[model samples]
Target: MKDTHKHQGLRNQLVKIISEKGITDKNVLNAIAAVPRHLFMDSGFVDFAYQDKAFPIAADQTISQPYTVAFQTQLLAIKPNQKILEIGTGSGYQTAVLIEIGAKVYTIERQLELFKKTKFFLPKLHYKPKKMVFGDGYKGLPEEAPFDGIIVTAGAPIVPNALLAQLKIGGKLVIPIGDEVQIMTLFVRNSEKDFEKHELGEFRFVPMLKEKN
Candidate 1:
């Protein structure tokens, strides 16, 4: 409930750390800097908020590392008002970053604990998505199909075809693909049936659960 000068100072240090790690996008950096990440976590873990690492949140989900969030966001190259679909709305941290960067977001979460908490929590921080649903991330959000960019926060055993199909032609899907550990993968829909794929480095994320777990 409090974003003090001390928290802002820590966030600035975090922004510097990630920048040194090679995050060059100013808007992305500003968004990361603007969002009070400490507020998203429990009071006990707030001290770890501005660190360059992920920490546990409710329902066993971990808010993604600052570096990882910045890296995925940098990959998207988002523009203001672009429609973005986010899979795995854990803590709604990444969703807040996207909203800060001015993207219209539609997000889904499978963990009902998080879904319900974040559904209301995000707006309290004045970071609201266009839609937030409690559902499966693997299937993506079909009704809001053809997203300008889709971001999957959790690791997937394989790239879900449904997510690929939901992308607008020329839109990008940034997801981590693998088990145990994941390789960050980006798929850009060039046409109805064609996608350009690039495999970035590795990352670790909670499994993208299916159905209501």
Candidate 2:
């Protein structure tokens, strides 16, 4: 639907809440404010769009909480026009944020329903990723390797070695690692085989599946 004044106001309030929660990256916050989160969600959940909570979307997946999106994006330290590989396109809300920040995104979605739906839906919102693939994210986009950043939207049991290999030297990978509760993890590629890792705390995300549904 329409992004009304009320929607914008709610977004402003949401931005403030995330900011207070320590999302200091202005670019990330601006992207969050700019996206019409309500439209990305199903109409039934529109009223709670800016509440910083996750809601069920199609394909048995949940659109991530707004705070989680901001937190992961902030960790990426995005720069305009950088190449970003996003695992799990989900509801495409996170894809919209990456596009808003001027990254060239190549996003992968494993669920066939979500892959087709989000592939068609995103362009309607004027958020166009460089490439949208229906494939296993664990494999990553090998042909399009050397990304400036890679974001895994779901919780992984272990970091995918393929993803690490695809990152450009000095690029960053933001992902959550665990099953029941994930620890927000960041990896900075220092060289071909070396990485600097950091654990940013706990979050809950849908499990990252290997095969397409």
Alpha-carbon TM-score of each model against the true structure: 0.98, 0.99
| Top-scoring candidate (lDDT) | 2
Q: How close is candidate 2 to the true structure, as a TM-score?
A: 0.99
Give a tens-digit lDDT track for model 1, residues 41-89: 9889988899898999999999999999999999999999999999999
Window of ten residues with lowest summed lDDT in model 2: 204-213
lDDT, model 2? 0.96
Candidate 2, residues 180-200, lDDT tens digits: the string is 999999999999889999999
Query: Cα lDDT for residue 46, model 1?
Result: 87
RMSD of 2: 0.8
Can you give the lDDT of residue 152 in candidate 1? 93
